[model samples]
Target: MYGPLPARDPVFSRPLQPRVHPAGAGGRLRQFRHDAFDRGMSPLLVVDHVQSAGPEMEPLPHAGLSVATLLFEHAQGEIESVDSAGARHCIRPGDLHWTLAGRGVVRQARARGESLSLDALQILVNSPSDLKQQPPASFHLAAAKVPLIALPGSRLRLLAGQLGAVRSPLVLPQPLLILDGRVDAGATVALPLPAGWNAWVYALSGELALEADGAGTRALPATTAVTAGAHLADVQLRIRGVGTRSHLVVVAGAAINEPLVQHGPFVMNTRQEVMRVVQDYEAGRLGRL
Candidate 1:
């Protein structure tokens, strides 16, 4: 087989209670539920949609999956949801918002300013039918609370992963790791792919040289693609850039692999029976024991 792997970036190797990705190396980017979706075991939808500064978005729906939003900036915005612990909430930069669409909660995003700018990450996590019995939960973390780690040659923000001593709040149902890394000019950063998970890299800004499966190195220009290795274990992402290279990388693996039937935010095994959910709601199943 292959020789023992090399050492990983020390900045990420030591940590406490952090959500580490399932192991392996790097892999190809395969569309999950749709062509536009990212390759997460759970259905992933990444969009760069343009929004008017003060425009309010339409009510969005989530039934069988977990929904989370991370705002970059653009101060004027609100997210309202009836089924959430906080029925209505506002969206602001460094805001870590998560909503469980149990019972199919609805929400809208209202942006302020003159056609305000919006940048956020919305994740859809797969949940089996049994979990649907649980009502939704919501949380908002200040932009400042997100863990930011600075290495000798690069900088990193642990949005959903652990970087050294920093940790994130958005707990994932699956074994997943999400990271945002910025490589300084002429700096090099190495990411150690877990032992059994798949890896995909998305270039958001700048350019860098990368080595995969030890097949030499190649330059990854901006807006490049995610690659799945011929073998699931050939997943390592190394970066070397004269200028800063900004990236968003997601590493994930197989789900619980159970039945994931869902309808209007209710995740259950059978679509035919929605009455229990109704009766439970009427009786405040979530509200009561």
Candidate 2:
């Protein structure tokens, strides 16, 4: 007989918070919800758009924020970006772009194709005070280079951080894990979550069920997100497909108990720091793009 299995905790499900639609040069972007620093997830601030696209954009300056972009769909166009650190790159479809607005930086993205169809996810995270002033860093993860795990009726992709025994190449300012998976109907998957880490599950398409041990099951629909935490033990989230097919993205990170203050593209620990960032940006401290 086999040895005893590992202890697993169930992942509770909840409804997505309010949705926000913001328009910019990136077209009209959809934001799922914002997590608070005290009662909810701290480091992960915003998850924007299951699918988003925009026309050519002018250069923009920012500070005190970190961004992660997941591009799952695109056409002939490419995205070119340059930051304050003088790092520049061009990104295509099925790629991930991470920008750390440590002290300050300037960035710009434009659609290159004639009629590009771009779909992506924009993630905003808060950096701790100690690392906020470090030089801005940026990375590009190609779609073909990302690792993939195949199951019986589902496929798992490691976007950031480690999963099981595999690790991702993309590095962030924080210890965060992001997974993208697609499951066929009638399939069930067990997702392991570390104890005490805050977790979020977003349904990209179709419907599914998320359940924990003591918590009841909840439905997950397309373009919706759910948050879960309070795991005293290792939680094994059970996700079952309730429709023809289901697509999901799971994000988890340790909670930061520090103060969080946000203003526009700036996210800092105190209002004083936020004001400093604004002044820095205005004084051209972030440098030209």
Candidate 3:
């Protein structure tokens, strides 16, 4: 992992398409995704500083993936939801939920309740195609139980993955780290990544000026990609911001290295397979509509 490298000023090189929420509406709404399969080997998308639109995510089907969500509450906030199996659960402010959707699990996500500016992040890790059938599981990590990495003039919440000296929340299929770092005005934190993994950091609250190796320098707007690479050894990050939990998702993973056929929430390997999944769902293969 590389660290303390200056952040590069960011210029959005490519236009970003809208996110895919599911179809249908009322009480709460979600974005529906059109099958967008381009940009091979790239799976990192930074959704920075998106205020909770009263986050209401219902049971949706997710196959072959794991999701990690963080809610950094300056005061208090909560997310409520029922599982695909109709189980009830909620995560309060400062708490986190890690969902591993294996094989064919029906899952739902929704954010409820509120406070002024309840900011947080969610990162998804693609499970290997062969292990998509693994039984899905959930882990709730307490805010106090998470590791805090202290730097010269900054403090970081070690959410997931590893930073040179600090370890992350759980063992993952891919090499990814999620850290929330806060630097006072002029304070700087060297963002070091691990070997055999690529890293990217997005600034959610404060404007960040970044300096990168090949990408040059640029300023990152809210919900922008700081650095992205195929392998872990190829990326580096650094930042200067004045804020708390300058919320960011540090993601690193090997490219799917194959056709990523995704129709809405199901990310499969081929269009034929994706079509089959749709047919199966329609035919009651996954169970329940």
Tens digits of per-residue lDDT for model 3 on 1-289?
8779655333112212335343312221111111231222244422323344454556577666666667775625576645554445676667667776665566666666535344555655566677565666676766777888877767787766777777866665555566766665556666554344444555655555554455555555555444444343544555665443344444555545545666676776767766766776666656552
CA lDDT of 272 in candidate 2?
90
Scored against the true structure, residue 183 in model 2 reaches a CA lDDT of: 85
Global lDDT of each candidate: 0.50, 0.74, 0.55
Error at 231, model 3, angstroms? 5.2
What TM-score would each prediction reach against the true structure? 0.64, 0.87, 0.73
The better-scoring model by lDDT among 1 and 2 is 2
Best by TM-score: 2
How much does candidate 2 score in TM-score?
0.87
- Best by the lDDT measure: 2
Question: Where's the lowest-lDDT run of ten residues in candidate 3?
Answer: 26-35
Estimate the overall C-alpha local distance difference test score of candidate 3: 0.55
lDDT of 1 at 64: 51
If the candidates were sorted by their lDDT against the true structure, best first, what order would they fall in?
A: 2, 3, 1
Q: Which scores better on TM-score, 1 or 2?
A: 2
Q: What local lDDT does model 1 show for residue 243?
A: 60
